[model samples]
Target: MNLIDTKNQLTEKKKHVEKVANVENATFMNIQLHAGEEVAEHDANKEVFIIVRKGKVRFIVEGEPVDVTPDNVLHMVPTERHSLHAIEESDILVIQVKP
Candidate 1:
């Protein structure tokens, strides 16, 4: 089994993105963002699942804003265009499933 300590990856910097795992069918990433930090718009080339681990974030998907928090999970189709803004200092786990 593989274990990851998500909290240990938190950073004081504006943003941090790290690949934690890459298996045959999926890739896992840990993203830490300070309050007000933003990830620019981009296309999701593969199916995606995003889990907010701490604080909150606003996901701009196809020009629509969707607020996400630790209590929720966000999914995106491969063709979706999206961007993220940290509403507060936040930690997020992103999983991309390969086709």
Candidate 2:
């Protein structure tokens, strides 16, 4: 059993990304973004799942625009192109599943 304190990690300012877990089949990352911050378009090397913890985010997935809010989840397949932009100060959890 493992317990992760997401709130404590999310509030930290020294690092934008906090690694939650890294196992043989998957990796978990917690990411925080200030308003107007963006993660440029890129392809995922592994299947990815993103869970919005707070605020809102805009996602460009395969040329389609999608908006995500708190409690929303987005899933992407390996090699899919996507980008993220924070609509407000936001917190997100990213899970990458190895193929």
Candidate 3:
């Protein structure tokens, strides 16, 4: 089984910015954000969906900031310039569709 404690997965990949995934057409990632970890602004070719699994986050999209916490899901358009920061230690499920 591929059961994993996501919190531990974050600890394991904390130093790396990307992870190898097994999804197609779309990519699925169990992402971890250390407290204060900030992802720089970038644009996507297709819509990107984020689901906060643990902790808190702030989504900076198009120079606007959206605060988030567990159970919150945010979807961003392909052309929107977006970035993310972990306001507290966080675990996020990210799904991106490739156009």
Best by TM-score: 1
lDDT tens per residue, model 1, 2-99 = 78766644444558899989999999999999889899999867999999989899999999999999899999999899999999988899999998
lDDT of 2 by residue, 1-99 (tens): 999877744355633877889999999999888888898899869999988888899999999999988767899999999999999888899999999
lDDT of model number 1: 0.90
lDDT of 2: 0.87
Full ranking by lDDT: 1, 2, 3
Clashing pairs in 3: none
Q: Would you list the clashing residue pairs of candidate 2?
A: none
Question: Which 10 consecutive positions of candidate 2 have the poorest summed lDDT?
Answer: 6-15
Residue pairs with clashing backbones, model 1: none
Worst 10 residues of 1 by lDDT: 5-14
lDDT by residue (tens digit), candidate 3, 1-99: 565444445555562244436556887777778888888888878788888878898998899999878767898878999888899888787788887
Residue 67 C-alpha lDDT in model 1 = 92
Question: RMSD of candidate 3 to the true fold?
Answer: 2.6
